[model samples]
Target chain A: MESLQRIDLVGFGSLLAQLQAEGYTLIGPRLEAGTIDYGAIEGPDDLPIGWRDEQSPGRYRTLPRNDRAHFGFNATPASFKTRLHRSEETVLEVQRGEQGELRFVPVIPAVKKQAWIGARSCELAALAIQDRVLKDSADPDPRYAARREGVFIVAVHCGQAGGTCFCTSMNAGPKAEGGFDLALTEILDGPEHHFVVETGSDAGAALLERIPHSQPTAADLRRAADAIEHARATMGRHLDTDGLKTALYAQAQHPGWEEVADRCLACGNCTAACPTCFCSSYEDQVELDGANARRTRHWDSCFNADFTHLAGGPVRASTPARYRQWLTHKLASWHDQFGTSGCVGCGRCITWCPVGIDITAEASRIRQANGEPPK
Target chain B: MPPTGTERPRLAVWKFASCDGCQLTLLDCEDELLALTDRVEIAYFPEASSRMLDGPYDLSLVEGSITTAEEAERIQDVRRQSKQLITIGACASAGGIQALRNFADIESFKRTVYAQPDTIESLATSTPIASQVPVDFELRGCPINKSQLLYVLNQALFGQRPTLPTHSLCGECKRAGVTCVMVAGGTPCLGPVTQAGCGALCPRHNRGCYGCFGPSETANTQALSPHLERLGMDPPALVRIYRTFNAAAPQFQAESQAHERD
Candidate 1:
């Protein structure tokens, strides 16, 4: 029995218009190049209102739902990190001065205010993880921090889980939890003809004030509760997160890794698609005059044969070695450094991987071989 | 050559046969680059610095594998000049992707890959730096971790033992709370035997590991081999895993040899 406000359909449109008037670039989900991706939104019409995503290993397809369920999906292939941490950033530039004193300039990325529409619970949790690694630290990443602070989030509750989603097992989930400013559950069966909006932040409350809406009735709340309940019940994917780290670590000597390494080509497609993977390498470039030195940062993957070249040679010379570093760090050592699990259980790595390697199945094999319960 | 009364440690970066990814790690330290420069004199690094000073350097970071006779000779000379020489990537520490040539006929591989085989001058097999000259330390990875690189350099500069993880990448993954890609997702990964580095990136992304950090200390490859077979991996495929970048490493080499029986 909590007090809630409901904005009429017209009021919601005007609020979005008001946001545009305020010079905020409103971006939401749009069918672009055959994918339901987050992009520029003119209004609600631009969103994939009747479309839902079907995600699985080596597959991502959008299908029309029976009813217009806006937030019917668990997670999308696209994560917010792609825009925040760009693929390439020029770190250095070298130029000769008039006096011939070599000058090197390090370039920092320009920050922007991004308003994200239809973000999910798991993605919100993921953003928190990014904050801890990139911005929450004592030496925060200025560029990432600026973008993070300026961005606004409009989270949508998942009414259905994708085939590859295991957010529930990861303790991240169907329900829109904390971290999002505004949480909305789109219920198509309701006669109220609107979204159930819950304010989770001051920004959300302020935005609510601008939208024309009235207080929600008891029936609307009941319907919202039912939609969430239905989503929780019909989850398509499940994972055992109980003692997962220990089960895998205990079998550290297990030969299953070599088996996996056999099929893996060390292409690094998984790391590229992952929402949380954030390892990077830097580069230096000199201007044509060779007087100034510039440094740049780019995404680096451990699977590459040169990721760890030293004066004498590389330490991990085998693909098995590189693969081990990736898995072990993610499951075991990340806790030591970051104090939380690095994986949010998004299965993008499985779908986008050219070889279609399933992470959960491999972990289970190792666990079973070691006479351990599936965790 | 003696230092010009400078107390700061002189650092040198060298490459043999590589893709230049490993040497790039040093330059990749964007936030720490300026600070690190203040601590050490970058005496030599042809790829990054235009000023290539004569060696007799304090510390030298070498990347790539010894794939030629000339490189073999150069490493020995480098060993003579540097006080501490650390091999950074898989190529230097083991043999690297080029080491794949080890399994095949060296002459045939050269002929197949290069249009003009005579233009390519290579050793019979790609080999690690340790096989050529004495190495003070070896940093494990396909490309060494920047954090680890920074740590090793700091330790060398301060004359302290660099505290690097000798455990498998599986150990790091467990600590990170990353779901086991192999266990949770049934994605084949190589965390058990592979060295700890790369911060368990593949699994964080929900994919199995393709070992790039080489083998860990006390890697029980024999035990893991049978399990891989149980998981439906054939011996040839398993051998390919062992024969990757770190194929020449004793641990991986022996494992690959065991699979050759099939």
Candidate 2:
């Protein structure tokens, strides 16, 4: 068992500087245009202090929390995957040299030793899933492997849940379980703004050895546990994952797909915002000179008409077919391929989808349509 | 015209009855235009040069809709003269913003816009070049995206089809990391049905997309119009949004016509 330590709000600011001193660039949740997104942070001041976000299906708005507590929001539209697996990557540049020789220049992305602060457990779980798919797999992406190798994580135990959040259902969040270097459970008692911090790795322990901290009391520890417990108990959404993969596989002809197709704009927002959707497509762009070209890989969605393009035409021609492919692949087929379900229950797909096509509700609808009891 | 010893593919830019913005897009490719000229000769562009080489051009870029009877006949001659005719913008692909006149009385429009209605030898409806003649390809955008126009040109040189994704602009907005204005702020957007071009211009500026890039391959405006209505768009506003740039596009035209009836 790991011992917990208490650090005041002032000490939190110093912790960021200490991480910087330790040669890890700090990336934390910072407010951008009323949304909290991960960005470069110099100290605790860069964090979204005293502001919280209200998120529901198809809606998200930031509100004043009526208190001065940092890291108040939950469930950003994007996650660490956005930074790690970029939207567009240039694999290499093919140069036409003098004397008719062709030179291939590989684009090795510049990797930085980064200390990511204020990561939620759902985001961490997403990283782990992406690790299985992109890093540890037989065909590991060298780009993802390089970027993932030099990163420090600071996980935050969730005290509040977004209206679309169902991390409890996915067994992916509401508390920092294990996949973090250091975990912070923010305590906002009357006149006491402090964090109950726990070191998960030796790096975290060494960093804590330098920062000012005190042994936590039993109440502080309970407060940390109770905060996450409250979030878990009052989760805004829920899904019964038991027999889910089998049921989803059996639901190939479910009428729920037609129902979703009626409202699905096929805009590909849910897949693009989804942290686990790893589909990509490549296009060769020729320079105006026509002598030089670059093969660019960009994030593509299954919802795209061109995603399943074959010799004659698209394999999944209809919107219903595309929607079915995305949902089933995310839940059922991913388990077969990666030994785990693709969804981390971050609820970004629900909140960011322009039409609010909630996956949890859709899953239940599909199951219930086939005479499965509602969980 | 006398045949020159140089055998560069002859490129022609033709304008009909619309704004010269699409033709200007080619001009805006100033340095790129210079490089493109190296591969293809600018045989007949009255806007770029006074040189007016006639007939049997290798590639013809038509820039406007057929709003006049003369242009309606002239486009066929252009199609006959060119080996490959590519429609450049919303004007030539769809009938463009000027096609809004198609919904109203052409007589009234003539009387309103011009002092002498009889002198204006215009057709009753503004129509795309495709309605008059066969086009090899139609680039759907208001003033076509510079890179896409260049992409089409590069592909045409190699005798390959330009494989531009005919997906919605929502994908572009998402890939660009732009927040969904429709979802987040309840702003009515046409991005769900609009094609991916203009690099998601309107949404990145924090406003709703106006569907200037026109409809995607599978544009479901019937479904999206209702959601836009839920976001406080009245029937006329819904029709107006779709009927803007690509007003005559069959998909958007159908949706707007339906809303107009409602």
Candidate that would win on lDDT? 2
TM-score of each: 0.60, 0.97
Q: Considering the two chains of model 2, state its CAPRI-style docking category.
A: medium
What lDDT tens digits, residue by residue, belong to model 2 across residues A1-375?
Answer: 346899987788788889898888888888886678888888888888999998888888888888987977898877888888889998878888766577888776767789989899899888989988889899988788888888998889998888999998888988868878889999987886799998888988888889899988888888888888888887788988888888888889888898899999898989998889889999888776756889888999999989989999999999999999998888789889888889988999999888889999988889877778767
Model 2 residue pairs with clashes: none
The window of 10 residues in a row where model 2 chain A has the poorest summed lDDT is A99-108
What is candidate 2's CA lDDT for residue B248? 94
Give the candidate number with the greatest TM-score: 2
lDDT at B39, model 2: 77
Tell me the tens digit of each residue's lDDT in model 1 across B34-104. 66776778999999979999979999999989889899899999999999999999999888888877777
Please give the clash total of every predicted structure, in order.
105, 0
Q: Taking the true A–B contacts (Cα pairs closer than 8 Å), what share appears in each candidate? A: 0.00, 0.70
Please give the DockQ score of every candidate, comma-separated.
Answer: 0.03, 0.56
Over B79-162, each residue of candidate 2 has an lDDT whose tens digit, in order, gives 999999999999888899889988899899888989888888878888999998888999878889988999999889877888
